[model samples]
Target: MGRIQMLNSYIDNLTMLQSLNLIDQAVSDGKHIHHSVVNAGKIVLMQKDVQLRESVNSADIINPDGQAVIWASKLLGRPLKERVAGIDLMENLVELAHQKGYKIYCLGAKEQVVSKVIEKYKQNYSKDIIAGYRNGYFSKEEEPGIAKDIAESGAQILFVAISSPKKENFLYDNRQALKSVNFIMGVGGSFDVVSGLVKRAPEWMQNIGLEWFYRFIQEPRRMWKRYLIGNSKFIFLTFKEKFKNKP
Candidate 1:
């Protein structure tokens, strides 16, 4: 996989299988790989959020999580191979954990949501694949302790499903405490989908880059600002970058 700069961020141009292979290699070699995925909204936010930029940019593997991001990359003359959606990556990693006899720790989502995810994972894969789990409802002071617990849980893979910036910061801040974990990733809202609390867009919508709209329609009041405003800003920024980079 190669890393390319686009839209003021770095994205690893990797297919889903490539990403899974890299993670598997890291885990097998007992090395640490901090993973992150960037979408249109996050790229726009990172323009003004220095910490978020640092946290995401510093990751060992950064994937394009939004189809809009893929389109923007092409517009800017740096086309990506595919969009590696966070939920899809998480699902593949869970299977990887099962196949490789690795354990994963799930941290994020509501209490019932995370619980249901763990239960479902146990049902789908074996319960042995779960190292530990906790709801994403801790305070700032609890962050260190939570990281410590995951580190000691014998988990080879760690997935944080909390919201952006917060999840990014938590993993960045506690990187030292979680040093033993072989792979670390931020999987926003993945638990909700896994727990059947949310529905994913159809394949055609995803292929056409309307997955965000599908989500927005599900809860317009909650997602209008995120999708509508955020996407507009992203489009503006992408064009701005394209002009700025002109030779």
Candidate 2:
């Protein structure tokens, strides 16, 4: 499939279903795939950070994860149908794993969150495809053993829920060692969402791209700084790029 090249990375040309199909094919063929998301704001911010830029560009599949990305696509006259959030993609992959009887491994999130997500998956899916899971709080020294464990489990699809940059770097650094897996997706905060430890914004809020606002209200102490400070910088950088016609 042809991809849409944004500033620093290429967003996958496929829709959600098409992306899922590609992942299924990769699993069937035993190919390693690293998937990430690119939003306009994120793209603009990462443009100034060489390491983050390289990591994002190296991802095998970069989906337009936020409404800002969809809006940017429309501005460029290549309108994406919808915002393909990473969490939604992670859930879809789990469903596909269940249908295909593929062993799945989840790495990231707190121990309780990961456990709860696994339990929720067992309750929800038609097939039990989860092979193993580990919390995201492990030390750097533990990664090699964890990688070995996933490989030994024969899991084909690995869902990683750690935060960005770090998760991308982990996959990049461990891709060779994780030969048993066909797909490794960086699904930020997905485990928390899936386990219902964190509530998503209402559909209306999400539709209007006010989901961040809802989150800010929900956890003012925690989210206020991220939204107030980080989001402001993101917006400023985005506009700077727009006016300068440069990333």
Candidate 3:
């Protein structure tokens, strides 16, 4: 799949099904595919952060994780087919892992949250699909050992639930040690949702691209700066690019 430039990053023009198929193929072929995604907040940050930009764009597949990102792609004259949201894709991969009997490594989120997700998978799917799991509380110095542990776990897919730049940089930096893993992607806060600590927006709200608003409403204090400032910056950049390219 080819990538299309949108703002400061390039996004894979793949629908959810296409992304899942690619992952399935990679699992079958025993190939490693590093995947990540971009949302408005991440895009806003990437514009000013060089290392983060490099890490995100270095992915084998970087898809549109936010509705604004998909809309911006169309606005920028490179229409992405759809948004391959991180959480949904992770669930799809989990189901795939269950059917294919591929093991998975879980990293990030609070210990209880991650544990709940692991339990949910075992209860809902199968127990064998989980290779190992760890909370997202380790320091930077502890990362190398963490990578080594995951590599030795024989997991086929690794889903990291840590925040943006940290998760992005971790995967990018540990690419060599994680080469044994078949598919790697970062799924921010997905464990919380799965654990029922936070609720996702209604389907109607999600369809209308207001999931961020829903999330902001849920925890305004924690998410206010991220949604408000980040989204505003994204809007400004989108129109700036649009105006700059006017014929």
Query: For all candidates, what are the clash counts?
Result: 0, 0, 0
> Candidate 3's residue-wise lDDT over 56-129, tens digit each?
99999998999998888888788989888899999999999999999999999999999999999999998999
**Clashes (candidate 1):** 0
lDDT, each prediction: 0.95, 0.79, 0.94
Note each model's CA RMSD in angstroms. Answer: 1.0, 2.4, 0.8
Q: Which ranges in model 2 have alpha carbons more than 4 Å from their true place?
A: 76-78, 245-247
Clash pairs, model 3 backbone: none
Question: Which candidate would rank higher by lDDT, 2 or 3?
Answer: 3
- Per-residue lDDT, model 1, residue 8, is 66
What's model 3's TM-score? 0.98
Stretches of candidate 3 off by over 4 Å are: none
Residues 1-247, model 2: lDDT tens digits? 7677755667877788888888888889888888778764467657687777777778888888877677766666666767888888888888788778988899999999999999988888843688889999877788888888888888888888897667777777777788778888788788988999999988898888887788789899987876677667756654554667554
Off by over 4 Å in 1: 245-247
